[model samples]
Target: MSSPVNIPFLSFISLDREAKTPIYLQLAQQLINAIQRGYLVPGAKMPGSRKLSELLSLHRKTVIAAYEDLHHQGWIAIEPNKGAFVMDNKTKMVERPYDALVSLGNYPTQTGYSFKQSNLLDNPFEESNCTYQWNDGLPDVRLTQFNQLSGLYSASLKRKGTAKKMSNNQASIYFKEQLSNYLNSSRGLHISKDNLLITRSTEMSLYIISQLIISAGDVVIVGELGLFTANMIFQSAKANLQTIPVDGQGIDVDALELKLTSTKIKAVYITPHHHYPTTVTLSAKRRVKLLQLAQEYGFVIIEDDYDYDFQYEKSTIMPLASADLNGMVIYTGTFGKSLAPSFSTGFVVAPKNLISEMQKYLGLLDRHGDVIMQQVLGEMIAEGDIHRHLKKSLKVYMERRDNCCELIAKHLGERVKFNKPSGGLGLWLNWQAPISLLQMAKFCTQKGLFIPKNILYQNRNFTAIRLGFGHLTMEEMEKSLEIMGEYLSSLP
Candidate 1:
């Protein structure tokens, strides 16, 4: 006699299920639990759809749908010519009956992406700088040498009488000197106070430039998988987004040629130093080619050097700002990623001819930045403290970066794959296992590690994850990687 096939069971997987939990889910979890408890073993054939449907006294489609859901969640594998079988899950999870849609709105109903208004501001958790536990990747707060900043603030107030009496686009004489030197030495661009304009932030600077240069309906070239918020910002500016695909080296120049047809493009926004989330540094050969293309195409290149200071490679790669002999590149930098000072302080290095008009436009936005901030940061750069801060933080983060790689390697071995960075903060990981990152992140969060999820598109398949280790300690890194590894293994 042949052994009997075991199918999905339920506590009350019935037809009269008008409860909050759906019949399919109630049946799915029970099946998942049965496998968890070893009642259903790997390679053991599932019950025939007809027999199980008859036994459970439910429609055959429901049981089949439940099984399909099981396969979708990586609990079972359905071979082309074979029946469904249990899969190998690295981490073991305790079975629980929970509601996934507790309060969130369903997505299929809302076609395009939409935001929900909430009083999320009222969350009572007193926020300390202790936010390192989440996988959101704590930014290096060591960049905040606040005492020196306080001294700088004092000097700015002393030098400039009041906020209203602050200097024009070139905020302070104190910062102007530093700005000139920084551009000359670091970027190999000789820019004077007449050429540099102080912006409140990089996004604002981009908006100002977009408003000046790009007209509504003008084509704007950006990376296919670019920064989410920045893409939306361009859209808000009324520029038509033309996405250029990126690979290991950087943007596909050949594909860029296809998009270029006269003055169709208003500008090109790029994180050329270290590509956002994707971590691939743009190649020098292509950098030169890109400048040539910009010259030929008559489109400006907006270089956003966010976190360019943390390069662990041979030397800090210069932005196209260095090679901008024709004044087509607009260089923007922020302290948001650099020193962890999350307030207003950003600069835009543009053509000397364009600076005056930009300043005029900036005046319309805000006459000048915070006088105290401008004065103090100027003093820091002038006093050589900024360099010292960068050196110290680089060494600390490099250690954390190496530690993260080691932990991932030791625990995950060869199953999961990732490329170590030549420089910069995060790692882009590609997983061979069949899993959704959104689901994995939720599981990771339940296991006391809150990972941030950015699933841009639902239709696309997920085979990778971006693990940010900048704000984590070596121990936390090791433990998190271990937990991630265990969770991955427990998939089945």
Candidate 2:
């Protein structure tokens, strides 16, 4: 037999025995790299597996396995008796130079072309590694009945006609019907399936609503301190947002009246259940006036009752959609915070005309939501599992809220001032001390606690923090508060 072709390039191939990657895979990858870099020219006859294995001090089977892999990937061709040869077209290999083929020991900084990011996504924060994290009004997912939910999901997947039924959108109809009944009974909403549109989450619902009503330069009113995410959605839609001051009684309706008189307002978004970031419930009188203004000025009222089921002190207030006589209210809510944010489901209740339009937009954004999940959640709602879960979660969360409040009082003392929110899962602690919120957050993080950048609110007129207590255990809450208190006390 003719002497096998001696490949000088084999001298450069090396393998790390301790590496978690298998030796065969390492050999295969190096050979593939050599082919891509043009070091092994196409049609070049390769050394016999036995000879190559002896030269590299590797088992013959290892070399054979690598060769088989390359052949499978079309990088090389195996002859009946001769041996292996490189394929003529190296296009199968990813483009890279021989020198660049060397491992860089870490992720590459840049690939061929780079593009600039939009200014809208500026000032992104890095992910935190702190052991203790304080979320923003999220539920304790640990308490969720996952076993039951899994059973429901499994049962749904096994249904004989599930695939065919979902294709026709029949699954969503059941969800809508169940959701309609639940809302009517729980939130005093008077609505049927025709007026309801289910969405993936509350954010999706807001985006759809913005698309339906907001146009370029259309005046949309929001509170001075509002949901930042929702504001981003409206701004993305090119709506001219007008911010009215929010006080102890929610958005200043009188100021809203002045804006309405001058400009043709398209929509006003309000979280009446518990104003985001502040946790102040909209007063009854303001709710009445706001509805009246919507009727008089011909603007749609986008009422977001995000956490209506978590009221601890008194009876929950009914949504504005319940008493909306002029059909001017577009109500949006989410079951995310009810059990766990991961299990989030959003729905909108509005006039039939608007609901139909919103569904058209929804179809474009998402043809249909999780059909199996929808069916599972529908069954949960119909069987009172959701209600019972809420009731049990409400009790647990209330205790946690109180525990958090006591810890803040004990640790922060006179340095922090906050009112016990009647409902909701967060506390808006107005810092009475002369310390920068950014500084305080950094100090807490150094001590193994994570406070997100968005929670640290500091502008010319506002200086406070919204601490969420729902997701944390009592022990974690206490430790986090102690760290926070120590930092504040150390401040001048």
**How would you encode candidate 1's per-residue C-alpha lDDT over 351-435 as one tens digit per residue?**
7778778888888888755766766677677888777877887888888888888888898788778788876777877666556
Query: Candidate 2, overall lDDT?
Result: 0.84
Put down candidate 2 lDDT per residue, 325-361, tens digits, no spaces: 9999999988645765656789999989999999899
lDDT of 2 at 187: 88
In candidate 1, stretches whose alpha carbon ends up further than 4 angstroms from where it belongs are: 1-138, 155-171, 261-263, 455-462
Q: Per-prediction TM-score, please?
A: 0.69, 0.81
RMSD (Cα, Å) of model 1:
20.8
lDDT of 2 at 423: 86
Prediction 1 global C-alpha lDDT: 0.71
Error of 2 at 413 (Å): 2.8
Off by over 4 Å in 2: 1-111, 114-116, 122-132, 155-168, 215-218, 261-264, 295-298, 360-368, 473-475
Query: What are the Cα lDDT values of the candidates?
Result: 0.71, 0.84
